[model samples]
Target chain A: MDKLQRNERIGILMKLLTDSPGKIFTLGNFTEIIGSAKSTISEDIDIIQDILDKFDLGMIVSIPGASGGIKFIPSISSEKADFITRNLCEELSQKERILPGGFVYMLDIIYNPVKIENIARIFTRQFYKKDVDYVITVETKGIPLAFATARFLNVPLIIVRHYNEATDGASVNINYVSGSKKKLQTMVLSLKSLKRNSKLLFIDDFMKGGGTAKGIMELAKEFECEVSGIGVLIKTAEPDRKLVDNYFSILTLDTVDEENGIINIRSSR
Target chain B: MDKLQRNERIGILMKLLTDSPGKIFTLGNFTEIIGSAKSTISEDIDIIQDILDKFDLGMIVSIPGASGGIKFIPSISSEKADFITRNLCEELSQKERILPGGFVYMLDIIYNPVKIENIARIFTRQFYKKDVDYVITVETKGIPLAFATARFLNVPLIIVRHYNEATDGASVNINYVSGSKKKLQTMVLSLKSLKRNSKLLFIDDFMKGGGTAKGIMELAKEFECEVSGIGVLIKTAEPDRKLVDNYFSILTLDTVDEENGIINIRSSR
Candidate 1:
């Protein structure tokens, strides 16, 4: 391949780094691809970092040592996170979202790729420091958010399901009570999903009683893995206390006035 | 913000356009963000496009008209797609993945964020021209791949579940025969998940009898939507005839010889 210009090299670098967040790329690797000197590549990385800082996109972190290399971290600035959460609260507060039995219709936001990407960025910023080996979530609504978070963190995702299938092979099952409903439910995970001593980050779309989070913790223990971090998009305020104490939530749902058609939700911050 | 240099502007543009795939951005929008003239921004976009093409990252499409701008289309070149699919087949055919009952354990691959991103890029290249309004899939293994495809296509995802929940409000349920197992199963989707007369793309991790795809087609009909496309990571070769005639698959699973501990798989291309 011919040598690439400075702008072209920068463009390719930015695309490759951001596309696989947290994956390390040595300077030598870039030098080989772009045919540039180590010093020139280092200067290019500094410029990319400056541009990232100026735009509030993300940060480029350099690991020091023999195996060290630079990687992209999907961290959102606090101001930008605040703005995103506020917009989300506004969108969720719309009266039209209030559904029967006081349930706020959130499938639209939770399943939306663009919105989920932003939400997962916030979660990544919160849990990226945990050095999570895997991002785990219960099947259904939480899958999208958890998948996006796993992508941003450059880790594998594990989905625990309500039931086991033949395709899953041997599995481990645990039962836990729903936090709010107080209903018993079972969680299933494939035995081969995680490695022993792995650290997991539990991500979900909603947390009403934190039952699912607790269930995930119990399930993780069965595999000798640890739940290092927990993050959710929304949590209810009425519970006051949850099954698990340490968790990060983007929004707090104060109440859903079914009769009056009002949804009182706010940013957790 | 201070004015950005040409390379800096190109970096930002590449990051923004690729991050939110298929999202249109007007020249004025770029000018306001980068503090550059419209003509200069145009030139930056041209450079970014060339870089993207040279690297086979993706393409920058120009949409010209009122209420139109430029969008990034996540298209993988055929050579790259072939290389990825072949690598996938080699990894999947490992003897360690052969499980009991002739089932190949694939949760690790399907749930892997990096692998899913590459697989979804291939799917996006196939279906992006369909102008799909939504990407839908059934619960369990397919969620991650479907979510990634939806992200690349910049569309909302609709997950059809096996059971109903109150949080989904009123859902439309349909029963279909499992093509391989020949057992009847139900699929439920929220009534409000899709707008009427929308184009839908069904994505999954594996296809046996294509019963799930058929079920999805039936469910789409209930919502007055059309199943414009179907894509899966792997399909069984035994069923030379699938329930669904038109679908794209990345790999063909010829046989999993449980007795002899041999697996035969090949790239669909």
Candidate 2:
């Protein structure tokens, strides 16, 4: 095969990395694609890594050893993350956005591909080095964010459904009490969704009392999987006692003044 | 800002294009990002486009006009698409996948981020030039695919729920008959999900009878919106008369031989 020019090689490398985020490509892989010497490919990767770092887009990690390979980890700089959090807080703070039961109208932000993609970058960076086998989330609102995170992680996304559906087939349904409302809720997952002992990362659109997260943990346990980490877009500040601890959130909703049409939201930092 | 070298410019351009596929970026935007002249940026874009073409990855579309800009439309080559469709067909053809009813156990594929991402690129390319305001899908299995398609299109994904939930908060509900069973079905969408007369593209994991797609159209009608197009991963061949006509599907499931565990599937050529 003929070697690609420097510019073209860099272009293809970026495309390959961006196409399959969190996937590691061995030196042989790059050499085969670019038809260049290992040393030349290594230099090109270093240049690409440097440019990515300088732009605050993402970083490439090269593992040493014959069995090691270079991996691309998507990330947003602190400044960018903060900006996104602040913007999201503002967008979600509108009085009209507050639902009757204190839930915010976050469908717009959660479903917005551009916003979710940036947020996914931030979340993926958190578990980039973790041994996460799958990204899990409950049905409805959390699906998009979870899918985004899974895409960046290059892993399969497992969704837990709220109601029994014929399509799921042989699902494991578990009932749990909602932490905030103390109401019974049932979450179901297909028996074939995940392999046993998989390390799963749970992500959601919102964390009220961590009831859903706890339920997810329980569900993972039922499958003999472990919940490696929990991430949420927003966690209510009033929930001083959460069912699950050690979770990460982008923003904290302090107060919602429905009367005055005001909401006090702060970035988690 | 200092001008970026050719290699660096190409790398950054690929990242930008990959980050927000199907979205247009003005030449001025690229020039600013690369800190170079518009001509240089244009040349760089041309080179990237050529490389993408040579690799059969996707295409760079340049719209000419005062309001025009360059758009990155992600696509899978026909060979790749056919391969994906064939693999998915085989995966879905298992007798175990065929539920008591005709529904197939599709949670795995729909939730699989990598597969959905590739399928999404195909769906997004189909409507890249259309004025699509939102990518709509029903809850459960279709959310991930809808989200993927929306992500590629850089649009908001609007999910229609099969059952009413408190979280949706005052949604627009519609009733439609399931095309296969002729049973009544209800689908609800948040009233705030879309604006009046917004153009929507509906996508789903499976299209048994196109009933859900038809329901989506009815729900969109309540908001005075129009469904520009509909795309599905699998459409059963038995349903000669579809509830919604003129929809694109990647694969058509011809027959499910339960006795021998054989599924006759064909790619939509």
Candidate 3:
């Protein structure tokens, strides 16, 4: 049997670790794939680890048990996070982003995979320690962010739909009052989407009066799950009184000038 | 400046290429970051390319001329894709997935990032040559798959919403008949989502009568954009006739036994 070159082993190792950010691959598995000794694989990982650390990309965590291997934890440095946040703030503050009724047109950012990937990294850094079973979000807009966050956390994403449908399979629907609009709304979730006694982290693109967040909490109750935390990309300053507490927001929408078509925003650093 | 070791250079290069799957990075940029010469970076890429080829992973394409350097194209081998598709089919065939009215409950697959990533890879590989400006999908279930495909294609994802909201700016709304339910449904997209003469690929989770796909075509016409392709994860076989043609589907739902909770399915391959 031929031995794998150092460059080849490192290249494949890098691909495996990066493809699934939070998944753990055993050293034995790497050795088998590369047809190398465990010691050689460990040395290769050291080099890979050094490169990741120097570039502030992420880290390779080694579990120290018989069944343990290596896991890649995706991360961005504080400097990079700050730069991304400020850039997003500037983008969101553009004059044209101010839609009618003080709503901001920021779907461009929400669905931009590159931008959302970075934002999800930041959100994961905040809640990675929570041992969450699933990442939850209310449909339609927040799906991407929540999906990205769940990808980083290596958890399943549970979506709460606004309307009940026969396709959802025995959903639990609840009526809640919208905090901002003060109108009755229905939120639905399939009973099979979540498991009982699970921990959930709720993420959304925008938060106003936290009415939806509050509704999510109520829905989780129906499934016997706990809402551990809430994260929003942009939280409005109006209706300063929020329906839910204990949430993290990256940016705050201070005000929107409808007549002048201007938006006032600030980062939550 | 000290030259970066081969292992370190390969590690970081792999990370850079894999992190943003389809994004291009210049040789000059790599040299500047690693403090290495162009010749050395080229050699490193050769080694990385060889490794990728050996493992049946994605490949690195070197573009010529002044504007190109290198781009990472993500892919999965035919064997792997078939395995994933079969696994997904088995999962979907479970009796619990059959809801009332013969609808299959597939929200779980839509929200599972790991699965969606693989599925997106399949879709992107199909339409990678189309030079699409945007990957479009109707909101809610299809967002994750669209976002994943857009990420791989290195394009923006445009979500068509069911209800127009103030946050969408000026949206173009059109009502279409539900091909299956025979009901009138409204679908919307922000007028600003696409540019004139742009190309788009429409993707969705399930296709019944292809009414939504047809609506997407009409909406794109409003923006003066062209629908280049359509991809759906699952298509119902009962709709002997579809509203759109030249579409790709991974799985076909032949029939559903709602009483026995059984689903008849087949692989498109």
Candidate 4:
């Protein structure tokens, strides 16, 4: 490959760093790829960091040591996060989202790639400090949100299904009661999913009674793992006390009045 | 925002365009955001496009005439795709991945964020020309892959579940036979999931008889939609004739010899 100009180097560096958040890259690595000196690459990184900071995109953290290197951390300013959450609350509170059973139909919002990415950025900011090894979630509605969170955190995702599949081989299953419904439900995870003593972050679309979060904690015990962090898109207001105490939620749902076509929701912040 | 420099403008433009693939952005929009002249923004875009071409990251497409603007399309070089597929084949054929019942454990690979991004890039290259409205998949293993593909294509993701939830409101349920197992299975999707007369792309982790793909086609018909493209990460060699005639696959699984601990797999290309 030929030598790259400063602008080209900045573009390439920005793309590479942002694409693989949390992955370390030594100065030598970039020097070899771009055919530049270590000093020049270091200067390029500073410029990229400045751009990232100015745009509120993310930050570049430089580690100091023999094996130390720089990595990208996905984050957003508090003001930006608040703005996004407010917009989400407005979109979700629309009367048309109410269904027959007082449920706010949120498939469009949760399954949307762009919106999920924004939401995941907030979750990543909340949980990145935990040094989570994996992002786990129950199947169905929470998969996309959890997947996006995992991507932002640069961790492997583990999905616990309601049932087992032949392709998963030997698995561990646990039963837990739903927090609000008090109904028994089985959570199945492949035995090979997690390493022993690993830390997990549980992400979900909704949390009514925190039953699912507690269930994940219990399931984590079976693998000799721990649920260090929990984040959800929405939580109910009536459940003043939840099964688990420590959690981050983007929005709070006060009520959904099917009769009046009213949805009372607000940002958690 | 202050007046940006050439390198900073390039970095910002690259990040914004790549982050939201397929979303149109007018030069006036960039001028307002970067506080630059329209002509300056146009020149910056040309430089960015040149850098993208040199790096094989992707291309910045220009759209002319009224109501037209430039958009980013996620793609990778054919050589890079081939290299990634070959590496995957090597890793998957390792004897350790072979499990009981001749099943290969692939949760780690499918759930991995970086690997899924690379694989999704290949899928985007394959199906982006279809102008797909949504990327659809069944629950469980395929969610992450489908989500990544939807992100790259800048479309909403629709997950068809095996059971119904009240949060989804009214749904349409259909029963189909599993391709390899020949057992009847049900797929449920919310009635409001897809728009009428929309084009859909089906993506999955694995395919044996392509029954799931075929079922997606059936489900599309009920919604007055059409399945415009199908892409899978891996397909079996035994089923020379699949239920679907047209589809794209990245790898082919020939056989897994349980006794000898030998697995045969190769890139589809």
DockQ of each: 0.88, 0.74, 0.81, 0.84
Residues A34-134, model 3: lDDT tens digits: 88888889899999888888988887877778878888888777887788899998898889777777778888899899999999988977887787999
Flag clash pairs in model 1.
none
Candidate 4 chain A lDDT trough over 10 residues, lowest sum: A28-37
Model 3, CA-based lDDT: 0.88
Clash number by candidate, in order: 0, 0, 0, 0
Question: Model 2, which residues run further than 4 Å from truth?
Answer: B94-103
DockQ of 3: 0.81
Model 4, C-alpha of B203: deviation from truth (Å)? 0.3
Rank order (by lDDT, best first): 1, 4, 3, 2
- How do the residues A1-269 of candidate 2 rate in per-residue lDDT, one tens digit apiece? 45689999899989998789888899899887778988888888888997898788888977788879988888768887888788887787778887775666778888888888888988987876786999999877888899999989989999888887777778899999888889999999888889998999999988888999999999999999999999998888977889999999988989877667788898988
Q: What local distance difference test score does each model get?
A: 0.92, 0.85, 0.88, 0.92
Q: What is the descending DockQ order?
A: 1, 4, 3, 2
Candidate 3 Cα outliers beyond 4 Å, as residue runs: A64-67, B259-261
| Candidate 4 DockQ, CA atoms | 0.84
Candidate 3 lDDT score at position A211:
93
Which pairs in model 2 have colliding backbones? none
Q: Please write out the lDDT profile of model 4 over residues B31-54, one tens digit for every residue.
A: 878899989888888888888888
- i-RMS values of the candidates, in order? 0.8, 1.7, 1.2, 0.9
Query: What TM-scores does chain A show, candidate by candidate in order?
Result: 0.99, 0.95, 0.95, 0.98
RMSD of each: 1.0, 1.8, 1.6, 1.0
Over the stretch A1-269, how does candidate 4's per-residue lDDT look in tens digits?
Answer: 87888988898898888888888899999887778999999999999999988989988988799999999988899988999999999999999889888989999999999999999999988988898999999997899999989988889999999999888889999999999999999999999999999999999999999999999999999999999999999999987999999999999999988888899999988
